[model samples]
Target chain A: MKILSTLILLVALALGSAQAQKFITKSGNIRFFSSTPIEDILAHNRQVNSALDQQTGDFVFRVLMKSFQFEKALMQEHFNENYVESDKFPNATFTGKVTNIKDIDFAKNGVYNAIVEGDLTIKGVTKKISEKGTFEVKDGKVIGKSTFNVLVEDYGIKIPGAVAKNIAKSIQIDVDVNLEKLE
Target chain B: MKKKWLIIIGGLAAAGIVLALLVYFFVYNKPHKDYSKAKPDFEVEAIAFFEEFRTNAAASSARYNGKVIAITGQLSSVEVTDEQVVALFEIDEGMFGSEGVRCVLIPEKAETLISIPPGSTITIKGHCTGYNETDVILEHCSIAI
Candidate 1:
């Protein structure tokens, strides 16, 4: 009887472990673009790291405030010191949940639309936002993507009137992430 | 008399502009402690190096303009930005030889140093260049293993 009980316990443990495979990617890419008729500006930070908890549907992302790269060094410097103040506010983080984990299966290959809600902290300010994303699972890999808009004034970023119209008050963000399941 | 006063005011304004220009380019150009002034082959821990770098780049936390060396406690924290992937690692008690002189790996072949976990025992190899407020830069760093 003891041997049978031990065998049953081992099987349960194996099943539990198999159900808890999580996926994460720290080198995720996030980009922001703003353009006008006269000029077009682009910025991106590839160091955006993120993790997804498969068991609980929790997710987290982090990026160094100084990591956002621009086309020119002068523009990079201005973005950090003058605009982002990277030193004072070192990182931007997002903590959210990918709703409907049960509806999605990692073993199968298909596109699944998920609702994500979380607190996005940027420029030392935290805002609650709800966004939708399409996640594709194929060949033991998961790819997630989302596009959203954030208003600068809502985050207390001030632009001088001389160049205010040049920069859009609302900035659009695109996130494309590729994650590998952690064994 | 009015013309003379106007001339004096204009001269003062010109001087102010020149002063602002000088401070921005030259004076602000010089960071605090100026580790580039440090002698070659000097070694220090990662935390100490980041502290100095942060103080120097008070106006702007940008990339290192010179060489640096550091020892961190973890390897996973190493990252690259601005054509430089500054390595960040933690020093463990078992790590010997450097004697607590933890290291930060800057870009220059950072690709080889992948899959390093935190609190793991390992050795790092790199050229010490300069300090940024957050990292003690190793210009060209690779994993010793």
Candidate 2:
């Protein structure tokens, strides 16, 4: 009986520690910009959900397509109806891992370069992406930030010839999230 | 007769230019909807709204996504930052974490949202973006009460 109790206690402690290593944020921010000689377009989405498991170096993000806000109503409508087709594909998700998780100490308060490789799905098309970003740990909170470029054609987005000059072929995406301990 | 035709052609060209300019400004530079002042398309309780998404995400998203909605529920938590203010109405315990309706309030409602404590029932009106499998996100929310 004593041995069984000891085994139970060990399992409980293991689960507790595992939970401590998880960090999450439901209000993460993602901004994308398209620049062209004729016109520049920008959109911001703040209702991003992200989770990072420090133990396994896994990071995931779920972004609602309709949440992206543009400066002009016409651009927002076109982006949803024509570009991304938000009605058909409502979410964009990324599931990736920090490949160099061993180099950074989560307990330390500093910034560390992180290499993340994962699958990004947008408008029902999935692509493998490898990008570099920084993770800053301060006062037990983790801030993950990265900027990367995404090709419009790679995601199956086709710009019409009439307004091609107004939109860039490549869009720059910026991700900023402050993650808190799950417990 | 030739001079009259030239003047008529010039007048038509000037009118065409003015019409094109008006169309460009009105169609291309239209402003975004003001969610704060917009009427809610659907008003529902928080739990029921969340359950619909949890049960049939695709169907619910098709019906509610990109629409203005009003939801009433007990506030589970409030997160405030310099950039944004968010109020959560937790509906269930999911694999990632607590999942429910997450309303990102407009800047004008920051003070009102902060004053309300957790467990108090309140109504929020905003633009329903869609369910992210974890939470039904609403942007540009304002306190309906």
Q: Write the per-residue lDDT of candidate 2 for residues B1-145, one digit (tens) a residue.
A: 9999999999999999999999998998888899999999999999999999999999999999999999999999997877888899998998778889999998889989999989999999999999998999998999998
| Stretch of 10 with least lDDT, candidate 2 chain A | A98-107
Error of 1 at B87 (Å): 6.9
- CAPRI quality level assigned to candidate 1 from its DockQ score: incorrect
**Model 1 per-residue lDDT tens digits across residues B1-21:** 999999999999999999999
Global Cα RMSD, each model: 8.7, 1.3
Any runs in candidate 1 off by more than 4 Å, and if so which?
A: A1-19, B1-145
Best by TM-score: 2
Instruction: Compose the digit string of candidate 1's lDDT tens values, residues A2-93.
Output: 99999999999987675456677645788887766655667886656677776778877876665565665555566667666665766678
Candidate 1 chain B has its poorest 10 consecutive residues by lDDT at B93-102
Judged by DockQ cut-offs, the docking class of candidate 2 is: high
DockQ of each candidate, alpha-carbon based: 0.10, 0.85
Quality of model 2 by C-alpha lDDT: 0.94
